[model samples]
Target: MSLKYAVLAALHEQPATGYDLTRNFRTRMANVWNASHQQIYRELAKMTEEGLLEVEEVPQESRPDRKLYRLSDAGTASLATWLAEPQGRPPTRDPLLVKLFGGDLVDPASLREEIERHRRNWQEELGRYQDIEAEYFSKPEQVPFRFRLQHLALRKGILAMEANLAWADEVAGVLKDELTSRP
Candidate 1:
């Protein structure tokens, strides 16, 4: 539900530096959750202070010291507690949906273009999910047990994106017909 839970879940996978977590957000959490580098680094510090994360500093020869983090027992407990609480899927508040609802006020053609743009973005996201699934999940035997757990979440994203793109197409068609039929 909270960013803290996501962070804990990630750290539970393996010990990682703040940079590593950020990279994971870009690739692994791209569909699920995305946090900026700054946000992640800040959360790491906060979690460390809260005793939910264990940090180990490793000296580097050329660069500054790196701090690797792992979930503490408290963090693990926290995550489990949160998980047991049956929270449904996250809600999305897209401004485009609002605009679409009142699209008659604007130029129909422009509104249709906006819907098309949103559809294109979702199409791109679906492609990314498909690519990741193919690259990492196709060979399930090679992946770790934890990765097998992730397959469902990844599949959920792929399905949601697909259904959304289909909905977008349907709405766009309606827009075209409605506009064209206007007296």
Candidate 2:
């Protein structure tokens, strides 16, 4: 998905300054999309020029003026149209998987170390997903629809991590057995 659509989606909830939007994106949309601060600022300017979003300047006493953005009618319509379209499958680009596929080219010790590292990474991700789920459950009434969507996404992520961890464990087991049985 384009960064414009993601920004529009975030603004759909409420108007927010660029900094606020960046922080929100990090928390709510981090799993699905990511944008650097510079990218977001640049997009905000471009989107404003395109008339897709409206910016309102909020004066501050001792700080720089904040330009809060809200979705214009055009932006809302654009987002709605995009949402109606079918989503394409995400392309896979996993370096670890590629390395694993080329296992025979690497030393056995290095290969095993990589697998162990992957297992640890997945375990950490699983923990983060579990924490997100718990936080969502704390205020169910505040985000009924969003909570459901988040839960579903978290479920898929957790399952994927679990599967990766399982595969890594199995590979590690085989490698250990082979090393021990070497004549």
Candidate 3:
């Protein structure tokens, strides 16, 4: 999907300043989409001009005014329309996977080390997801109904991390065996 839809969906959650939206993209929406702060700010300006977002200027004592963004009527309709459309699985373009496809060109030991590093990164991400779940979703009944869907999305990220770890373990074992069997 387009960044426009992602921005609209984020604004739908609640009004936020550009900085707030960037923070959410880094943390809460990290699993679903990635966008730079510059890109988000640009989109906010574009959407505001397009009448998809309403901006409120809030003055600050020590800082410049904050432009708080909220989804306008048109934006809500736009988001709803996009949500109703069929979504295909996004194509995977992992850099590590692409590099591995040419693994014969590289030293096996070096490739294995890279794989281990990748595994470690995924492990860290899994911990973050688990922390979010424990902190916010531990008590299902306590969670507001509106947030249950978000919980479900987070679950997908957790499952993906778990699956990646398992796959990494299997591949690392194969690489280790290869290294040992080399005459």
Candidate 4:
């Protein structure tokens, strides 16, 4: 629901430094929620002050000390409570979709170009999700029961990317045959 909850979910997995959380966000969590490094670090500070996280500073010889954050029991309770509550679909705000709503007035060629770009992006995203799935979820038998939910979330991402690519293909085909062929 909030950045605070995302941070709590990350730390719920394991204790990690802010940098570690940022890396996780880039690699896997980005599928669910995207946050810049600065946003993450700032949220971590706020969470720390809110008593949702406990930080342990580990000093390094040549490098700066790293603050490893762990979820407090209160945070754990909060996370569990939040998970139990239902989440509503977020209000849509996709500019491309909004523009596509006016298909009769819009130029077909331009719309096709935009769809092509979106298809390319979805393809790239699918590749990344597939790589993660193969690397981690391939051998579900080997995974502990605790990680099943994580795999489930990853599956959702892969499916979403696949669906988006499929829709893009259909839209492009329609534009080429019907829309673009007209005056």
Candidate 5:
């Protein structure tokens, strides 16, 4: 999906300044989509020009005025239409997987180290996901019905991290055995 749709969905939650949207992308929406602040600000401007977003300037006493963006009527309809359309899984394009496919050329030990690094990253992310689950979804049933889907999205991330960790461990084990058997 395009980043435009992600931006629309974020604004649909609530109006926000470009900075706030960037922060949300780094935190709340990190698992779903990744975009730089520049990309986000640029998209905001384009959407505003396209009549998909409405920008309201809020005055501030000390700092410069802030531009808050909200989804326009057209944006709402656009988002709804996109949501109703069926989605297919996008193809995965992970560099690590590609590297693993030709692991025989590289030193097995070095490849294992790279896999370990990825494993550590996945572990760290999994911990963060668990923290979010505990803080927001401790009592799932008590959560508002509207947010259940958000929780489900988090679940998807959690499961994905778990799967990656499992796969990495298995690959690392195979590489370790190969290294041990060599000498």
Candidate 6:
């Protein structure tokens, strides 16, 4: 999905400044979609020009004025249409899988190190997912539908990480066996 749609979806819940949107993306949307602050700011500008989003300047005494963005009627309609469309297959681009496919030509020590690193990353990701889950459980009633979508994404991420960690451990075991049996 395009950043425009993501931005529109975020604004659908409530109006927010660009900075607020950025924080929302990082904390709540990071599992499903990622966007840099610059990208979000640029998309907000484009959406404003396209009449999909409306921006209001909120004056501040001690800081720069904030431009709060809200979804226009066009933006809401666009988001509804996009959400109604069927999702296509996601493109796969796993760098670790590419490296593993070329394992026969790789140095055994280096491959083992890479696998260990992947295991660590998965562990960290699992922790993040667990945190999200915990937060959801803490306030079931307050959880929004969009946040529910994010929770599902986090569940998928958690499972993916578990599978990766299992695969890495198995590969490491095989590599160890090969090294020990080398004649």
In the predicted model 3, the residue pairs found to clash are none
lDDT of 1: 0.88
Candidate 4 Cα outliers beyond 4 Å, as residue runs: none
Tens digits of per-residue lDDT for model 5 on 59-83?
9999999999999999999999999
What local lDDT does model 2 show for residue 3? 93
Poorest 10 consecutive residues by lDDT, candidate 6: 132-141
What's the lDDT for all of these models? 0.88, 0.83, 0.90, 0.88, 0.92, 0.85
Can you tell me which runs of candidate 5 are displaced by over 4 Å?
Answer: none
Q: Which stretches of candidate 6 lie over 4 Å from their true place?
A: 139-146
Task: Give me the displacement of residue 173 in model 2, in angstroms.
Answer: 2.4
Each model's RMSD to truth, in Å?
Answer: 1.8, 2.3, 1.3, 1.4, 1.2, 2.0
Candidate 1 lDDT trough over 10 residues, lowest sum: 25-34
Q: Write the per-residue lDDT of candidate 2 for residues 1-183, one digit (tens) a residue.
A: 889988988898789999998987676566656899888999999999999999899999999998999999999998899989999988999997788678777766787898888788889878876777677655555676956776676678778888988898889997788667767
Worst 10 residues of 4 by lDDT: 174-183
TM-score of predicted model 6? 0.89
User: Which candidate number would show the highest lDDT if scored against the true structure?
Assistant: 5
| Model 1 misplacement above 4 A | 88-92, 141-145
Candidate 4 residue-wise lDDT, 1-183, digit = tens: 888888888898899998999999987776878999999999989888988889999999999998999999888988899989999988989998887899758788889999999999999999998898888889977898767878888889999999998999888898889764677
Off by over 4 Å in 3: none
* TM-score between candidate 3 and the true structure: 0.95
Cα RMSD for predicted model 2: 2.3
Indicate the worst ten consecutive residues by lDDT in candidate 5.
142-151
